[model samples]
Target: MALHNKIGKIGEDIAVKYLRQEGYYIIERNYRNKFGEIDIIAAKNNYTIFIEVKSRSSENYIELAQSLYYKQIAHLRRAAIFYFSEKNIHLSLIRFDLIALKIDPAARRIDKLKHFKNIID
Candidate 1:
């Protein structure tokens, strides 16, 4: 894999581990459709969460927040709608999330992991 891909995969693995530790049941990873791709899907407390994982080696949390654009959000929402319909899940049971990770790939460490829940609104 390319270096960036490897880094992204590692960041995703870290995000999944953190979510599992926090009692979320992982349902899917890298979910894709005609609209776009959702990096993670998990269930917790009766909610099906569609997650977008963003990783950067040097940027801080503020930069990460700015990186999530309206266009990407729109794509995610459309993809999530498709996911919920195809999976027979109710719209009311869904949540949109963004997990931003500041990782040190060489050290295999996450300097920071920010979980932004219900980000669609």
Candidate 2:
């Protein structure tokens, strides 16, 4: 795979591990539809979460938090609605989460992982 793709996959793996450790039950990864793609779908307590994972190496950490745009958020919301309907899930306690990670694939380490809950709404 291309270097960026490899890094993305590694970052996703790290996000999954972190989510699991935090007691989120992973329902899916890379969930997609005509609207867009959701990186992770998980359930915790009373919420169904649609997560967008953004990762960068230490060299690019400064660019991490600003990656998501309003247009992308709209797409995610549309896709999430489709996902809920297809899965027969209710929208009552749904949330959108953004997990930004600073990772070092060469060292197999995550320098930082920040979770922003309900980021879209």
Candidate 3:
């Protein structure tokens, strides 16, 4: 894989670890449908969460936070809906989340990770 894609996968891995630590049961990773791919799909406290993971080098921390645009957020919802439809699962408590990761270039380690819950309305 390319360096950027590899870094993104690592970011997703970090995101999964963080979510598990937060008591979320992972349902899937890199779940893709007609709309797009959801980086993580997890469940916690009766809610199903669709998450987008963004990763970047430490110097681009600001870009990481702002990377998720409005259209991307809409696509997340569309993907979630498609997932529910494909699985025949009724939507009860569903939400969107965003996980941003800033990695140290030299160490290839996470310098920062932030989880934003219910990021999309």
Q: Name the top lDDT candidate.
A: 1
* Candidate 1 residue spans exceeding 4 A from truth: none
> Candidate 2, residue 3: CA error in Å?
1.1
TM-score of each candidate structure, all chains considered together: 0.94, 0.92, 0.91
lDDT for each residue of candidate 1 in 16-115, tens digit (9 for 90 to 100): 9999999999999999999999999999999989999988888895478668899999999999999988887665878898899999999989999999
Shift of residue 77 alpha carbon in model 2, Å: 0.4
Give the per-residue lDDT of model 3 (tens digit) for 12-110.
888888899989999999998889999889999999998889998745665666788889878888999999999999968998888888976457688
lDDT of each: 0.90, 0.87, 0.85
Instruction: List the candidates ranked by lDDT, beginning with the highest.
Output: 1, 2, 3
Which window of 10 residues has the lowest lDDT sum in candidate 1?
59-68
In candidate 1, list every pair of residues with a backbone clash. Answer: none
Error of 3 at 80 (Å): 0.5
